[model samples]
Target: MNSNQKKLVKSTVPVLQTNGTDLTKHFYSRMFKHHPELKNLFNMSNQASGKQQHALAGAVLAYAEHIENPEVLINVLKSIGNKHVSLNISPEQYDIVGHHLISSIKEVLGEAASDDLIEAWTEAYNELAQIMISIEAELYQSNLKKEGGWKGWRTFIISEITEESSEVKSFYLKPKDQASIADYLPGQYLSVKLFIPALGHEQARQYSLSSAFNPEYYRISVKKESNGNVPEGVVSNMLHHKKTGDEIWVSAPSGVFHAGVESNQPLVLISGGIGITPLLSMLETNKKRLQENTTVWLHSCRNEKVHAFKDNVDRLNQDSEWLTTHVFYETLSQNGNDSVKEGRINLAELRDEVLIDDAKYYICGPEVFIKVQYDSLIKLGVAQEDILYEEFGPQLLHFN
Candidate 1:
């Protein structure tokens, strides 16, 4: 873009910071109305809760603030690109999104909107879209080039289903063609798309792989979100209701959150509630391949009834000589008994148990919990580079 266009986009930074989510909310509604088929691509649950809008708002504001040096946002771009590739987002959809976004800006700003401002925004959107499309294309090409991999979605049959907990179940999915599946770095997630009859549309949701990468099958442990009256988690609930022998569409594992297999540093895996899925994969993979590395799993949940993989972790602990596991229950059981420590998983409380000073910490959980765990680890003298965490939805990370 020219200097004048850049200036126009920069001037709108304040407005976007203040009203970006509102604009994106309007944009999504308009797009979905005009292009109902897109409902299959987007997570309506996230849309309803405003997470998708908030995420877009953050990205837009960031782009506007860094328009002159777009490379500064390369990390964010890579993260979004990975997700887009997992969702099979194509470059052609950029035009559809741009059209609605511009319309939303015009509708939201009303008389305050100007032709020059809209034109400048159009250019900016195109530029950003091109960058994202290019990155996504690279990711797609890389994934397709991997052994036993293909582009777009593949059919996977649910060969087995195991109830891990009252709210969580593990679905063992194998390729429908009985072919080998591409291997993924431990801690990555799979994007599963299924048709939801209630919404009258197909929906895609990313579920962290709960086990180590295997050519035979992938395991995703889903926590059914059926609390209260909120209609969110439509796909998760659908998966919970599904049985073995059902076929589901799945994308190759994708995400930047994973342990570095090459690193020989001690590994610390911390998780809360169902967020343990990806971390479990990391722990399992570490045990299988990197047995020499010292590993510890620190987890928190409501209680035994809700803890998903206690038996699995117990088996790993018994088999591995260098592994230690700790569980923190939020509340006691019905019998008011507890075998592990009581209360939330606080890093400070377990400082003595943290044997390694320069260990790599991997965390996954709710937004607030992840932030707390990250900050706590920092306070414990862990270098920022040694700590990594993944937020399930739109990343709101502000790396210091």
Candidate 2:
């Protein structure tokens, strides 16, 4: 964009800072009204909780704040673009979104939406859209060229459903066409799409692969998210209700959060609650290569009843001395349980066990858990580059 357009975009930063969420909320409502079919592609649960709106609002504010140097937003754009590829977002839809977004800006601003301002925003939106399209095109091509990968959604048959815990269930999925499955990185996730009867539309949710990569099948363990007060999880509840011999749609695994399999650095895996999914994959993948300086897994959950994959961790421990594990339960049913600690996994308390020199740490959990662990690690003198974290939803963390 030209200098005048940049100035126009920058001038809206104040308005966006104060009214971004309202604008995005209105934008989504208007866009969905005109393009109802797109409902199938969105996570209705996030929409209901207003997380999606909050995420988009943050993105808009970030864009306006960095309008003069858009390259500064490259990481954010790459993260979003990878997700878009997993969702099979097409280029044509960009036009629809741009039209609605600009229209929403006009509608929200009312008389303040001058022609010059709208024109500048139009150019800015087009530029961002093109960047996304180019990035997604490259991602699609790369995934398509992989040996067992395909673009868009592929049919998968659930061959088995193993109840792992009171709240989590593991589904063993095999390609219905009997095609070989792609080998995904240990920390990667796959998008699963299914029809929600209540919503009368399909909804897609990303679930981390919970086990090591297998050529024959892929495994995803889902924690049912119904806690009475919170809205019922459409996809998680549906997956829990499903039985053997059921079918679902799955996209190729895609995620930037991953452990370096070839690196010999000491690995620290910290997880809380249901966040253990992807970290479990990384641990399982490294099981065979465990040495004295292998991987360490520190996990925390509500109690033994909700703890998943205990047997798997035990069996892995028996195989090699490389996998060291420490389990913490917030509310243990038995006080004398020798195997588990009765408290949250506090990094400060376990500084000796963790904080190894030259260790690469991977954490996954709720926002609070991630922030706590990240801050603790930083306080313990760990480099920011050495700490990797994965959030279930949008990329909201901005590291300095």
Candidate 3:
């Protein structure tokens, strides 16, 4: 904020740009060394894969790039806030992160990290921390304002578990209190926290609300990760282990990936694999509301066996004349023919088959998939404002 801080930020940009990955690697190693307990706070597999480390470095560099104007970082801050909320990252953890972050910077920069530089980074970290804390606090407050919302986590008894596919299962959850739950907007997500004895404390994950918001209950479809890494998505595997009447902790619904129910424009929802959860909710809600003019749903999966909610999607399509649904399976069945296609969804297919000229597009999927779709949409002449996307990681969908 001050002249010295501004200078430091500007100088740090080059260093960050050049050695961002190295700095992040060192940062985490040092952090874990000092506070081994905090290791559980991060995804170890993500660290091993270098995705989380690179993401953190990229975020730090981006913050520095926009240090002179904090407003430019609003989208980044919001995304981080959502992720933190999903992780159940506490305000207290921010202090721990900040302390280690500064130390890491100094350790990496060595003599070049002067007193003024340290002070500047410290101030910047404090500023970023304050912004995140305030945003998360607001999110928490909003969740609590809703009727079924509660602070921290609340016990939700699993009423039923239906296997949607070999890898995916849908869990029907109801608050143990028996009171009416707050209705969430279609495409929103709920943060589920799990207390793993092996991992210690609690770990959290976010899953999109797969069913239309009803006062009675909520539904989430989770696909078990078979790679056997990252603690198996703590919350998701926990749900898999649950059965009828099992109690689980769930936070209030929160997310910005909801549909524009108020808009009259055409809506195109594109998804891949487990990403169908949110889009399914939007489609179901639209069918119920009869707001189905010019709506298109495109989903991609590997095969019929792993494709979830097929029956529900088929039923919705058969029942709602206003909605059009398309499923693309990469692998062919015994009939030796694929339903729609036999490969990944690309811009060519999207532009040719899915996207409408004047439609508002909502895309959710893996990071690479979303990026490709986004670039294709733009290349196809769709305005930036017309495309909405949500990534699981801390990346800004819209920078401008």
Candidate 4:
């Protein structure tokens, strides 16, 4: 874009900071109204909860503020590109989104929206969209290059369903074509699409691959969301009701949360509640890879009733001496509760034992859980680059 176009995008930063969500909300409203088929590609639950809008708003504001040097936003844009590729979003769809977004800006800004400003934004949006399209194309090619992987969605059969806890179940997915499956990083996830009958359209959700990568199958442990009214747990509930041999559309595994296996530093996997999914994969994969990294798992849950994968962790530890497990039960108020401690997982108190020199920390769980642990670790003198966490939903998890 030219200097004038860049200036036009920069000038909109203030308005975006103030009314970005409103603009994205209007964009989605108009997009879905005109193209109802697009609903199948979005998580309606997130749409209803306003998380999708808020996330898009943050993204827009960031892009506008950094319009002068969009190259600096490559990392953030790549993450979004990963999601878009997982959903099999096509390049042609960008034009539709751009139209609705430009129209939304005009409708929201009213008389202030001049022809020149609109023209500038049109060029600006196209530039970003092209960058995104290129990123997604590269991602698709990367996945396709892996044996047993392809672009877009593939049908997978639920071969086995194992009950892990009162609220969570493990679904073993295998490609219906009976072909080998590509290996994913321990902390990666795959998008699973299911049809929501009540909504009269399909919905997709990303679930962490709970086990180590293998050729036979990919495992995703899902916690049935039991709270709230209709549509709250719609997709998960539908998944839980599905019997063995049922088929679901699945995207190739994609995520940037996993750690590098080459690092010989100590590995710490901390989790709360059902957020243990991806962390579990990390722990399991470390064993399969036979890495020399000394690993520690610090987990907190309400009680043993909701604790998943306790046996798997125990068996893995028994087979080898590479892993250590620590548990904290929230409801335990007395001794002999078969837990290491009570209340939430405390890095400060356990630092002496669980904390290792030159260790990288991986955390996953609720938003607040991640924040508390992140803040605590930082206060304990851990380097910011050594700690990483993944949020479980469509919401943007940011720390600044």
Candidate 5:
């Protein structure tokens, strides 16, 4: 970037850091007023909670912070690019977003927003937008070049359904044309889009691939959330309403949460409730690869009745001497049978039960669960570089 661009980026950082929320609220309000159609494009719930708006503002500010050395922001850019691709956010939309963003900044900063400041922000936005567009284009090309990957949406027909639990069902998806699906690394996710009549247009959400990568089909286990207030996960709820042979739109696989098979160190997989889906894929993939090493799988669920894939884990443990599985049940049934543990997975109990030193840890679950596990891992002197995580929501902004 030129010195002028660098100056612009540096100047805006403080403004964004201080007034980002207000700027985002103003930006969204203005954008929606002009383009009411885009209201459906964003997560209204996230907007109401102020998470999505704050996340976007934080991202823009972070991007500006590294404008002089754009290479440092590659991973951040890639993550957002994947999300945008899933949301089907078009390049044209960037122009719309940029205009409102600049206008909001000017309106918020008032006297501080001089002619030079406006020019600098415009230049910075253009530069960042160019970077995003180029990166997204590369992602599009890579997916298309893959054996079974394609651009835009493709039809996947539900081949079968297996009951994982009373509330969870696993759907096996195969291309309607019987074409092979892209082979993804364990822990990757697929973006599924649904056309909701009430909401209009299409809404997309990412679900982790629960089964190991196979040419025949992909599997996703979804738990039905019937909470009276908040709406259930859009795509998941839609999938639940469909029957065998129903078709849905799915994007090619993408994510960076997979285990690093290249490393020879012991692997530790930690999960709670439905978070077990991705971890199971990793374990299954390792089993298929015949990777014999000390691997620990720690899973926590409310009770045995709701735990999915117990049989699969049991079979893997019996077959592989290197695999050890631990199950923590939060609610034990009546009678002191100890058949199910009666409380949340105690980090102290976990540390006492399992040895984690010299192992790479992968954690996934709700924000609070992940936070507890993460703090415990750090307390145990685990290196930050050795621990990785995948959040179900937009909580990446808080990470380093």
Candidate 6:
């Protein structure tokens, strides 16, 4: 974009900061009204909860904030691209979104949206959309080129379901056609699209693959999110009701949040609550490598009943001297295991295990859990580059 166009976009940063969520909420309502069929591609639960709106608002604000150097937003855009690829977002749909977004800006701004102002935003959105489309195109191609890979969705049968915890269940899915499934990194996630009879439209949710990669099947551990802390999870409840031999639509595994298998650095895996799903997969994969340096896992949950994979981690801990673990429960855990501690995680308490030389830290959990860990690490002098995280659900994917 030209200097004038860039200035126009940047000038809207203040407006975006204050009214971004409302703008995106308006955009969604307008878009859905014009094209109801697109409803199948979004998570209506997030729509209802306003998480999706908040996320888009944040994205737009970030774009305008960094309009002068859009490349700096590449990481954020790549994260969104991963989600877009999972949903089979098409290039043609960008035009539809662009039209609605520009229209929303015009309609909401009223007299403030002069012809020049509209032209500038139009250019800015076009530029941003091109970058997004390119990123998604590369992601689609990567998935397509993988062994046993295909674009869009495929039918998978629920071969097995086991309750991992009081609130969490594991579902082992095998291709109904008996075809090979694409191999994925241990921390990657796959999208599950299912028909919600109540909504009268299909809804999709991304669940982290809970086990190490296997050619025969893919597994996802889902937590029933009915705790009233967040929006009630419609898909999680429906998934819990599933039976063996049930079929659901699943897309190829996609995500940017994965452990670097090529790295030999000592690994630190931290999780809170249901965030353990992907980290558990990472833990399992790390166990197989048997790296020379010790591996540490720190997990926090409300209590033993809701603590998933407790035994599995314990077994791995017992079997490998290279592995160490720490568990924290808000409520007392009567398992009488030395690994269990009462209270939330404190990095200061376990400094020796986590502050290893050149250790790579991978964290997954709620926003607060991640931010606390990140801040703790920084205070303890750990480099920011070494701390990586995967935010759950449709929210700001980046940590401040």
Q: Across residues 1-400, which tens digit of lDDT does each residue of candidate 3 receive?
A: 7977887887889899999889899999988888887764576646667877888988898889888888877866786786677556799999989998999989999999999999999999999899999999988787678877766677899998999999899989999989778778888888776677666656666789998888888998898876466455555676788889988888778787788665667878889888888988888887777777577888888988988988898887777776777778888687764346677766665566566667888898888778877888788788998888877644534435
RMSD of 5: 2.5
Report, for every candidate in turn, its global Cα lDDT versus the true structure: 0.88, 0.89, 0.80, 0.88, 0.80, 0.89
Q: What's the lDDT of the predicted structure labeled candidate 1?
A: 0.88
Q: Cα RMSD (Å) per model? A: 1.8, 1.7, 2.3, 1.7, 2.5, 1.7
Candidate 3 C-alpha error for residue 80, in Å? 1.6
Off by over 4 Å in 6: 227-231, 290-293, 333-336
Per-residue alpha-carbon lDDT of candidate 4 for residues 128-188, written as tens digits (9 for 90 to 100) = 9999999999999999999887888899999999999989999999999998888788898
TM-score of each: 0.95, 0.96, 0.92, 0.95, 0.91, 0.97
- The true-versus-predicted C-alpha distance at residue 79 of model 6, in Å, is 0.7
Model 5: CA > 4 A from native: 1-8, 227-232, 261-263, 335-340, 352-358
Spell out the clash pairs found in candidate 4.
none
Model 2, C-alpha of 256: deviation from truth (Å): 0.7
Worst 10 residues of 1 by lDDT: 226-235
CA deviation > 4 Å runs, candidate 4: 333-336
Best-fitting candidate, scored by TM-score: 6
For all candidates, the clash counts are 0, 0, 0, 0, 0, 0
Q: What digit string (tens of lDDT, one per residue) describes model 5 on residues 305-390?
A: 89899888988888898898777887765654333456676656677545566788889888888888888888777788888888
Alpha carbon lDDT at 350, candidate 4: 83
Output the TM-score of candidate 1.
0.95
The candidates, ranked best first by TM-score, are 6, 2, 4, 1, 3, 5
TM-score for model 5?
A: 0.91
Please write out the lDDT profile of model 2 over residues 215-265, one tens digit for every residue: 999999999988343235767888899989999999999988888777788
After TM-score superposition, what is the CA distance of residue 147 in candidate 1 from its true location, in Å?
1.2
